[model samples]
Target: MAMGKVPGDSEGGDEVGFAEINITPLTDIFLVLLIIFMVTSSVIVQQAPSGGAQTGLKVNLPKGGATDVTARATDMSVAILSDGRFVLGGNIVTEDELKRAFNDAQQKDPDTIVIVQADEGVPHGTVVQVMELAKGAGLGQLAIGVREPQ
Candidate 1:
């Protein structure tokens, strides 16, 4: 708030004050809050897990020299845990369920690529079995997920 005196209107030398609302402080507060929210929102979005994928799982992928593969909206993901658990599209799926899910994806899009993310400690047979299932379900495009060498 601001106060100003009307000097000429008071003949008795008594100054009358007028009140004015100052908005600079309020504007500064809003701007600070906006910046805080912007930064926090961006951090939250970056940490947020992607849908229909095993984003939360910690699979130590083997570093390789394979070409980079970009993810697409129609792509399917199969995560094989080190403990022999199978996660299909972010859900724990049995072998039968995995087969059904692959078939469903194949029917939905014949070109849908199935990316297999298996832990480095996982058995080779398990990985091969998953690949075979994907092929048996009529999915031709398959990719093995591997991290780039540092």
Candidate 2:
């Protein structure tokens, strides 16, 4: 709000009303909306499910003495169940399909690392076979997934 006189009016005359736009309220609304968006975005990210073996078949990973390693975007995850089932990319896959997947990954990126997650009850030979399959498909980097010792 403001007060001003007409151009020809005397300075000592009565003051006339002049409207002035106020933006404080508009600024406050935008700041509140920004905060709401930030809060909701963080909540959504925290609630989202992770993509990989964690979402695949349940496997009781054996405890290992190796240091912890985090998953990478380009890394491939393969899971072997206790009953000798093969799971790739969150789906049960045949040995042939698994080989195709490895080949595709290797063709896409030869340096792609394969992370094998075998159940504690899985046979040692099965793990070796899967590793050899990856090697045959031209994938060299391999890693074994294990849980940290309690």
Candidate 3:
């Protein structure tokens, strides 16, 4: 049989090269993935509660517009949860541990600033008590954490 000719064919058809690429399926897959990603992202955004409070305990912090400042490496944080628990750098700590942490920080830098974040539900006296402990640990600088009123 001649090249490009059927078994009983007298005339041969024009030669055909490679077959055309089929992009429709690829395009469909890409579009489906894009839609899935878009839907998931939107759901995540919607499911997350706003107001910038992202902690294990719900803390309705007092709203105030204090001076906006960047946190320093030497700066320390003390959070007072609504349940009267103390959190240092996101970890729950006992009063003794809190005192030790402050002492360690003070040993490294005498002027270490202690930022106090107390929940609105927390009693004022407890916040003051933490501040007193920070002072006893030789920390000289102290700042309170408050969210900007919305």
Give Cα-based local distance difference scores for all models: 0.85, 0.87, 0.84
lDDT of 1: 0.85
- Give the deviation of candidate 1 from the true structure as CA RMSD: 17.1
What are the TM-scores, per candidate, against the unseen true structure?
0.55, 0.55, 0.55
Q: List model 1 lDDT by residue over 1-150, tens digit each.
A: 344557676556545556666789999999999999998776555332445543443456789655677889999989999999999767899999999998998999999899999999999999999999999999988899988779
- Over all chains combined, what TM-score does candidate 3 have? 0.55
Off by over 4 Å in 1: 1-67
The sequence of per-residue lDDT tens digits that candidate 3 reaches over residues 1-150 is 223433465577564444456789999999999999998776555322565633443446899655665579999988999999999988999999999999999999997889999999999999999999999988978889889789
Q: Global CA lDDT of candidate 2, please?
A: 0.87
- Give the C-alpha miss distance for residue 86 in model 2, angstroms: 0.5
> Residue 90 error for model 3, in Å?
1.4
Q: Give the TM-score of candidate 2.
A: 0.55
